[model samples]
Target: MKKILAALLIVVSQNVLAQTTQKPVLHGKNWVAITGKPLAATAGAMTFQKGGNAVDAACAMLAATCTMWDVLSWGGETQALIYHPGQKKVFGINALGVAPSGATVDYFKDNDMEYPPAFGPLAATTPGTFGGIITMLAEYGTLSLKDVLEPAMQMAQGYPIEAQTANQIESNKDKVKEWPYSKAVFLPHMGEEREAPHAGEIFVQEDLYNTLKKLVDTEQKALSEGKSRKEALQLAYDRFYTGDIAEEIVRSVKEQGGLFEMEDLANWQVKIEDPLHVNYKGIDVFKLREWTQGPALLQSLNILENFDLKKMGYNSANYINTIYQTMSLAFADRDFYYGDPDFGQASPMEGLLSKQYAKERAKLIQERNVEDIGPGDPYPFQGGTNPFKDLLEKRKDALSYFEPENPISGLEDPFLEEFLLGTTTVQAADAEGWVVSITPSGGWVPAVIAGETGIGLSQRMQSFVLNEKLNPFNVLEPGKRPRVTLTPSMALKDGRPFLSFAVQGGDTQDQNLLQFFLNVVEFDMTVQEAAEAANINSYQMQSSFGAHESKPGAISLSTQTPPWVRNELKKRGYKMDFQERTSGPINAIWFDWKHGTFWGGSSNHGEDYGIAW
Candidate 1:
C-alpha cells in the first residue's frame, strides 16, 4: 500500500508541475504576432503565409476579431500605430467615431438625463472601424480588403463559440434580449427556452456575414470599373460611410429614437496623423496624441526617467511606490488636459512632454500616496490655459466623486457599467521590418445592433462629457472626436522598430503598457517574463468614464505580488485592494535588430494567443 501511494504521489506532483510551467515565448525568423483571440492570430499568420505584410496581417487579425470576439463589433472604433521601415516613420490612425450632428447638450437635457444611457441607440456614435481598416490597407497593406476580410466573413457565418465568448454572451443576455436584432445574433433561441450559446456550440450570424459580403461586393464592383486598388478601396469605404449602409444606419438610429443623421455619416473620415513620442534612455516610445490617453505613458516615462528604477529593484516596494505616484501625477494632468485637440482648443502637448515640465512634475511624487492633485500649469511651456481649473473649482463640493466609487470595481463606476466595458488589441511584425499595433474596440454587448445592417453602433459617445460648458471634451459639435481611451503603442530602438504592443483595459491601458515597457527595458526581462509579472494600478486620478470618479490613495496589487509589498503599501497609507489581476491582458511582439529575430508574448490571464513562424 505504501509503494502504491508513493507512486500515485509522484504522478500527481508531475501533473501539477506540468500545469504550472510557463509557456515559452514564441520565436520566429520571418514573423511573429499576438492577438486577443486564437482564431484572430491564426488569421494573421495565414495572411503572412499569403505574402501579406505586417499591416495586412494586423488588419486581417482585427477583422477576424470583430467576427470571433463578442467584445468587439463590425461597426466599432479602432486605432492603429504603424511603423514603416522604409520611411522610418510611425503613423497614427485615429479611427474613433465622433458625436452626431444632433447630439447636443440640449438633447440630453430635453430627455431629462445628465448623461447618455450605458447601452442603447442614444449611446451610439458614427462607426469608424471599417474606414480605419480600409485606410490602412490603402496606404500600407499589400492585400486587398476582400482578401483580408474573407476569414472574418466565414467566421461570422458560423463558428463554434468558445468558453470566453459564451461567458460574455451570457453575461449580456439580459440586454441582448431587449433588442430584436441583438437577440437574433446573440440569443437566437430566446423564445425556445434555451440559454445563451454554450461553449463549443455553433453560433451563426447570417446578418453579419451578409453585411461583410456587401462591402466585398462593393469593392469588387469598383475594381471591375477599372479603378486602382486604392481607389477601389475608397469606393468600398464610401459605401459604408456615405452609401446604402450609411442610410440604413441612420434610418435605424432614427427609428430607434436616437440622435443620428445622414450628415454625420457623410462627414466622417479617419484622421491619419503623426504619432507623438518621447525618448527614454536611447529608445523612442510612440503613441497617439491628446485624443487618447497615450500621451500619459510618455509623461510617466519622462518623470520616471529621473529615477533609478533598476537600482530600486523590480517589483520592490520603493519601485512600486515611485511608479504609482508618478502615474498618479501624469493621469491627473491627462484628465484635465488631454482631449480632442482640434475641438478642445490648444492642448499642452509640447509642455506636458517637455523634459523640464516632467522634472517639475516629478517633484510631486512623495514618500506617501496623494490623490486628486489636479491639472498643472503647462501653458507656460506648451501654450494653453488650464481648462479644468474652473471646472475643478466648480465641482469642489463634489471632489469625492472623482475617486472610483467601489474599491473592487476595477476602475468602473457601478452606475455606468456597460459604457465602460470595452476594448481588445492585436499586433504583428513581418520580415521586412514593418510593424503594426492596433486596438479595435467599442460596439460590443452594451451597443445596440443597427436594424438589418448587422453592424452594432459604438457607445463611444458616452466618453464625451454631457456638460459642454466647462468640459473641453464635451463640445457637442458634429465632427468633434470624443476623447478616447483606445491607445496602441510602438517603440523604436536605434532608429528601427523595436516593439509593438497594446491592451484592452480602458483607463488602465497606458498604465499596463508603461509597466510592461519598464519591465523589459529597465529590468532586462524578456517580453514574456515582463508580461507575466504582477502589476500595480493606482486609482488616485479621475476616471475616463462618464462618472469620472477617483479613489484617493487607492491602489490595487495583483495577487501574485509578495505579501510583504502589500503590507509596505498599506503602511504608506495607501487604501489597498487585492485583485487576481490589475490590468488588461497584453499582446506584444519584440524585434531583435542584431539577431534578426522576432519574439512574441501574450497574457495567460485571458484567451490571448501568440505565434511565430
Candidate 2:
C-alpha cells in the first residue's frame, strides 16, 4: 500500500510541474511593449508597426485594455510616467479624480454610513481615463486620437472575454446583478441567471463602442475645419469631460443617489508635473509625487540604500527581512504623510528621501522582527512641524474600533481584498528613446455602469477617509483628488532612459517593483528572471483601504521560496504566511542602452503579453 501511494504521488508531482508555463524574454531593437492582456499588446504592437512612437502605442494599449479588461473601463483613473528624451526629463500625469462638492464626511454621516460603499454611484469619482490618454496624445504622441482609438473601438464592438475577466465577472455577479446597466453589459446573455460568459465567448459593449466612436467623430469634425491635431484632440477631450458624455454620466450618478455633478466633470483635467525620483545604487528610479503611493517606493528605496544589498545576497533571510522591515517603515510614513500634495500644507519628500532620515529609520529594524511603526518626524528635516503626529495618536485610540479580532487567513486578508479592486498596466518604448509606463485602474467588478454610455464610474471615492479630524486624506472641499495607490515606475541609468514598468497590485505595486528592480541591478538577473523569482510582501503597516487595518509583523512569502529561508525568517520572530507565488502580474521593458536593444517580460499569472518588433 505504501509503495502504491508513493508511485501516485510521483505522478501527481510530475503533472503539476508539466502544467507550469515558462515565459520567454522578448527582445527587439526598434520597439518593445507589454500589457496585462494579450489583445491590448496586439493593439500596441499594431500601432508601433504603423510607425507610431511609444506614446502613441501606449495610448492605444490603454484604450484596448479599457475595452477587454473589465477591471479597467473608460470611466477610470490613470497615472502615467513618461520619459521624453528630447527634453531630457520625465513627466508625471496625475489623472486621478477628486471628491465631489457634496462628498463631505457630514454627507455620509447623514446617510448613516461610516465608509463609502465599495460598489455604487455614491463611490464613483469623475472618470479620468479619457482625459489622461487624450492629454498624453496631445502633448507627446505623434498619432491622431482616431488612429490610436480605432483598435479599441473595434474591440468594444465585440471581443472574446478571457478566462481572468470571466472569472472576475462571475465572482462579483451577485453584486453586479443588482445594477441593471452593469448586468446588461457584463451578464448580457445570462437572462436573469447572472452567469458570466464562458472563456472565449464573444462579449460586446455596443454603448462603449458608440461612446468611443463619438469621441473620434468629434475630433474629425474639428479637423474638417482645418484645426491642428492638438485643437482636434482638445475637442475630443471636451466631448468626454464637458460635453454630452459628461452630462449623461452626471445624470446617471445623481439619479442613483450619488453626488457627482456637471461642475466636477467640466473642471476635470489631468495635472502634468515633474516626477519624483531617488538615486538607488547607480540608477535613478522615478515615480509620481504624494497624491499616489509612488513616493512610498522612493522612501523604501532610500531606506534600503542604507544597506549593502549585494552583500546580504538576493532572497536571503537577512535580505528579505531587511527589505520587509524597511518597507513597513516606509508604508507607515505613507499612511501619515502621503496625501494630495496640493492640498496639504507641508510635503515630506525632502525628509522621506533624505539619507539621514533613512539611517534614523533603519535603526528601528533590529535583530528580532519589529511590527507596526508609526510615521516618523520627517518635518524636522524639512523645517516644518510634523502634521501627522497628532493624527497618528488619535488613530491609535481609534484602532480599537477598527482592528479585526480574529486573525485573518492570507487569502481573505485586507491585502488581497484591496488588490482585487484591480488595475491594468502598459509599457512601451520606441527606438527613438521615448518610453511610457501607465497604470489604468478603477471601474472594477460590481461597478456602476453609467446609463447608455458604456462607461462605468470609478469607485475611487472608497479611498477617501470619512474621519476629517484624524485622516489627512479626509473628505473636505470638492476637487481635492484622493490619495491613490496607482503608482507607475521608470528608471534612468547614467542620465539616459533605462527602463519602464508598472504593476497593478494596489499597495503591493511598489513592493513588487522594488524587488524586481533589485533583481536586475543588484543581483545581475535578467528582467524575466527577476520578475519570476520568489518575493516577499509585508502587511505590517496600515492597508490603503477598508478600515486601514494593520497586522503588525505580518509578512507573506512565496511558497516557492526555499524551506531554509522560511524557517530562518520564522526563527527571527516574524509572522509569516506562504502564498503559491508573488502577487503581481507585473509588466516591464528594459532599455539596454549599451546595446541599443529593448528587452521585455510580462507575467503569465493572468493573460499578460509581451511583444517586440
Candidate 3:
C-alpha cells in the first residue's frame, strides 16, 4: 500500500507540472511584443521592424493601446518597469497623475461622499500617459517620437472598432451621455437604437488624430530649429503640459466643473524612480515603489519563501489555503501601510519587506483560514516604535464592518465587479537586451472625453481615501499621488533580465503575479503555460476601485479546480465561488539566456495577443 501511494503521488506531481497551453509560446530571436489588443501588439512589432529598440517599441505599443482605448487613453496614468541592457539595471517610470489642486479629503467629505465618485470629470487626475511615453522615448529610446507615434496616429485617423469596446460603449451609453464631449464621440448615431459604433465599423477620431499630430509636429519644428534630439523631445513635452494643449485641457476641465488647472498640468512631471526589489531565492524581483500596491508582492514572496511550494502540489487544498492566508496577511499590510511614500507620512517599507517580518507573519498562519487577518506591525523590525498602533487597533475593530456582502455564487456580484476592474498590459523585448513591462490603465469605455483633445480623462482620483484612518499616507491632497493598483513586474537572475510581466486586474494584480511567478520558477512551466494557468483570487484586501470595500472570507476558484480541493477549502472556512477563467489577461516575456532568445506569453482570457520574430 505504501509503494502504491508513492507511485500515485509521483503521477499526480507529473500531471500537475505538465500543462498544455491553449496558445503556443511565442518565440523571438530579435524581438517580441504582447498587449491587450492585436493591433497594439502589431504596432510594437512595426516599431521593432523600423529599427527601434524595445523601449521605442514599448512606447509605440502604449500609444496604440491608448488610441484603441484598451481600457486606457492619453489622459490616463502609466506605470512601467524597464530592464536597461546598457546599465544592467531596472528603471521605474512613475507617470501616475496626482490629485488636482481642489482635490482634498475635506472637500470630498463635505460633499457627503464616502470616497470620490468612480467616474466623471470630477474624478480626473492630471494626465500622465503622454508624459510617460515621451520621457521614455527621450531618455532610453533611439527612435524619434514621430517614429513611435506613427502607428497610433494612423489608427486614430480610423480603425475598425472591436466588439468588446463597441458593446461596452453601448451598454454604458446612459453614463456616456452625462459628458457632452463623450456623447459626441461615442454615439455616432445619436438617434439610432444602437448609438455606439458597430464592431468593424470605421471609427474615426479626428480630434485625437490632430492632437497626436501636434506633438509630432512640435518635435519636427524643434529639430528644424537646430535643437538636439533630447531637447526636441523636451520641447514637445512642454507643448503638452505648459503650451496650447495645457490651455485647452484646463479650459474644458473648468467648463465641465472638473478640478484641473494650468498649474496642475504644468507642475505634473514624470518621475524616473528606482524600483523596489526583493531577492526570491536566486532571482531578484523588481516592482514600482510603495506608491503603488507593488510592495505587497514582495512581502508575500518573503513569507512564501519559507515553504516548498512544489511539494504542496499545484492548486492543491493545502497550497490554496497557504496562498490565500499568506496573501491575506500581506494585503492586510498593503491596505493600511502602502501609500505614496513621498507624501504626508513615510511608509515603513524597509520592515514590510524584511525577512524577519515575513517569518513573523508567516508564523501566524493556522491550519484553518484566518478570518480576521489584519496588518502586522513592521516598525520594530526596522528599529522604530509603531506610530500607527492606535490606528491599527481601531482598524482591527472595524474589520467586521467591512466584511464582504453575503456570499454570491456567480461572477456578477457587485463586489467581484469592483474587485476585477480592468486595465491593459504591454510587454516588449529585443535582442539587444532591452525589456519593458507596463500596466497602463484608467479611462475605459464610458469614459468622459476631455473636450476636443479626444482624450478620456482618468478616474484614478477615486483611488484616494478621504480619511486618515483609512490610510494616512494616501489621503487625498493637492498634488499628491493616489496609491494606485497598477504595477509592472520584472525579475533578474544573476545580473541579467529573467522575466518581464504584468496583468490587467485591479487589487488582484499582485495575487495573480505571485502565482504566475511561482508557476514559471518553481513548477518549471513555460511562460505560455504560466500565463494560462488557473489563479485563485482573494477578495480579502480593500479594493482600489469603487467603494473601497473588502470581502474577508470570499475566494474565487477556477472551474477546472477539482471537487475534492473545493471541498477541502470549504472545510477550512472559505466562502467559495467559481469562475470559468480566473487568470486576468497576464502578458509575460521570459529571456531564454541559454537559447539567446525570448519566449512571450499572452493569456487566453481576452483579446490579448502577441507577435515575435
Candidate 4:
C-alpha cells in the first residue's frame, strides 16, 4: 500500500507538469513571486510557504490583483503564458475576449467610427480570465478554490486605493468623465486622499466582492455536490459567462451600443497553443508564440549568440547598432504578418531564423547607416497559418457600409501623447517551478473602470492593422486579436527552469527579454542584473501610420544609453527618446544551481511594481 501510494504521487506530479509548463527546474525548497504590488506578491508567496505550489500562488495573486490593479481584471479578458518544467512543454492560455457573432468592420463604418472605442459596454467581450485562473488552479495546484481566494475576497471588499493606483487614476481621471460608474468607484471623496489606498483609505468594490464570492461558493458547492474538476470549472464559467451574469452583461451592453451576444460568449474557448521554443546556443528559451512578438526575442538572441556581445562590448557603439538593426528586421516581419492565429498569421520563426536568412538579413545592416526597411520576405515566413480566413471575410461582409470618405490624409493623428501601458506578474515555487506572466490587454487609462464589469478593455485591437494586409496564411479579421507583444518567458538549461521573466513597455518587452536571456545563458549574469541593465527598444508598429510611417532604421534609443553609444545610432539616422530611463518594469525569478538558492525580484523602476520573498 505504501509503495502504491508513492507511485500515485509520481503519477499525479507528472500530470501536473504536463498541464502547466514546458520546463521545470529546482534549487532547494525556495520560492519567489513578483508583481506590480508588493502586498499581492507577498500574499502569493505566503501560499507557497504554506505548502501551495505555483498554480495556487498564481491563483491567489490573480484574484487579489483584480481588486488592486485594473490592467487585466476579471472585469476584462486575460491571456496567460505558462511554463511547466517537469513536462518540458510551455503552455499558453488565451483568456482574451471574443467578438460577437454580429460583429463586423462595417458595423462600425456604418456608425461612422474609424476604430472601436476602448471603453464602455460595446467593447465588452466574454471575460474568461478569472475562469481561466480557476481552471489552472484545479488542474495544477493543490489548494482549494476557497482557500486560495479568501485573501483576494477580503481585499476586494475594501482594499485601500494604493498611492500608485490613485496617482494613475488621478492622472487619467478625464477618461472616466463619461462613465458615472467609473467615477464613483475611483473618486470616493474630494481632496485629502488617504495616505495610501491599501493602508488607510478604504477602496470598496461591492459587486466585484460579491462576484468573487459566487465563484468561490459555487466551486465549493460543486465539490460538495461531487462534481468532476472539468464539471466544476464549466459550472463556474457558465455562472459568469453564460448564466445569470452573462444575461445581465448582454442587457447592459445593449443599452450602451455594445457588440456582444450569448452565442459569441458561448463560442469563446481557451486555446492550447504551441509554446515559442528556440535553441539559443545550447540553452532553451521558451516564450509565447507568434500570437505575440515573443518569438522576436528568441530570434534576436539567436543572432546575438553568434557574436560575443561582450567582445563588441556591452552597450558599445557597434554592439547597440547591431542589436538595433537586427531587432528592426524582426519588428518589420511582426507588423506585416502577425495577428491572432484565429485571425492572421505572421511566422517569425521559420526559415526566418535560419543561418541563410539570418546571414541575409544581417547583411542589410552596415553597422553605420540605418537602411530603411518596410516589410519583406526574407525566406518566405511560414510560422503557422490561420484556418478561419475565408469564413471571417464572409461574416464581415454581412454588415453594410455607410458614407465613404477619402482616407485621412497628411498625418491625420494630431496628438502629441506618450503612452505607457502594460501589466505583468512573475512568480516561482519550490515544488511547482517558476512563472512569468505579462497580463497586458489595456493600459492605465479610462479604458478600464473601477467597478465596471469590463474594467477598461485591453486595446489589443490597436495591434491590428487598418489596411487589408496578408500574412503567410493569415489575414486581419475585424475585431480579432492583434499579434501582441506580451511574452511570459522561462530560461531553461537542459529542461531545467533557470529563470522566469516578463517585462512591461510594449515593443520593449521583447527587447528587454532578449537582454535578460543572454545575461543568464551567455554572460552568466544573475537574473536581477540582467533585468536591471539599460534597454534599447525598437518599434512594433509604425508608432503611428498617419500620413507617414517610421519605417525600419527609424529606431529609437533610450536616452539612458551613454552619449557615445547614442551618437553612433544617431549618426545612423535612428530616432531617439532620451529618457532618464526608457525601459520597463522587468519582473523575474532565478534558481541558482550551485548554491541551491532561489533569488528573484521585479524591476527597480516602473514605480507601480515590486517584489516580495
List TM-score per model, in order: 0.93, 0.94, 0.96, 0.82
Cα lDDT of model 4 by residue, 42-95, tens digit:
668667767787777877777667667645565555556566656756677766
Candidate 2 runs further than 4 Å off: 1-21, 192-194, 400-415, 468-470, 473-476
Q: How far is candidate 3 from the true structure (C-alpha RMSD, Å)?
A: 5.7
- lDDT (10s digit) by residue, model 2, range 1-613: 9999999999999977764336878889999878888898999999998889999999999999888754778888999999997998999998888788688878877888766666788787889998999999999999888899989998888888888888889888888877878888888668645488888899889999999999999999999999999999999999888899888888878877788889999987789999899998888999998888888888888888788999999889999889988888888777767778777574678988888888899989876677646778887876777766767677665441232433347777655576434588989999888999998898877788998899988878777776743456544457877778898999998889877878877778888888988888889877777767777877666666665566776677888788998789888877777888774777888877778899897886767898998
Query: Quick one: best lDDT, which candidate?
Result: 3
**Model 4, C-alpha of 80: deviation from truth (Å):** 3.1
Rank ordering of all candidates by TM-score, starting from the highest? 3, 2, 1, 4
Off by over 4 Å in 4: 1-28, 112-114, 122-125, 190-200, 344-349, 353-355, 369-371, 378-419, 432-440, 448-456, 470-479, 544-560, 607-613
lDDT accuracy of residue 240 in candidate 4:
75
- Badly placed stretches (over 4 Å) of model 1 are 1-21, 383-389, 395-406, 409-422, 468-470
Q: Which ten residues in a row have the lowest lDDT in candidate 1?
A: 411-420
Question: Could you tally the backbone clashes for each prediction?
Answer: 7, 0, 0, 16
Instruction: State in Å the error of residue 410, model 4.
Output: 24
Q: Native-vs-model 1 lDDT?
A: 0.80
Q: Which candidate comes out best when scored by TM-score?
A: 3
Alpha-carbon deviation at 486 in model 1, angstroms: 0.9
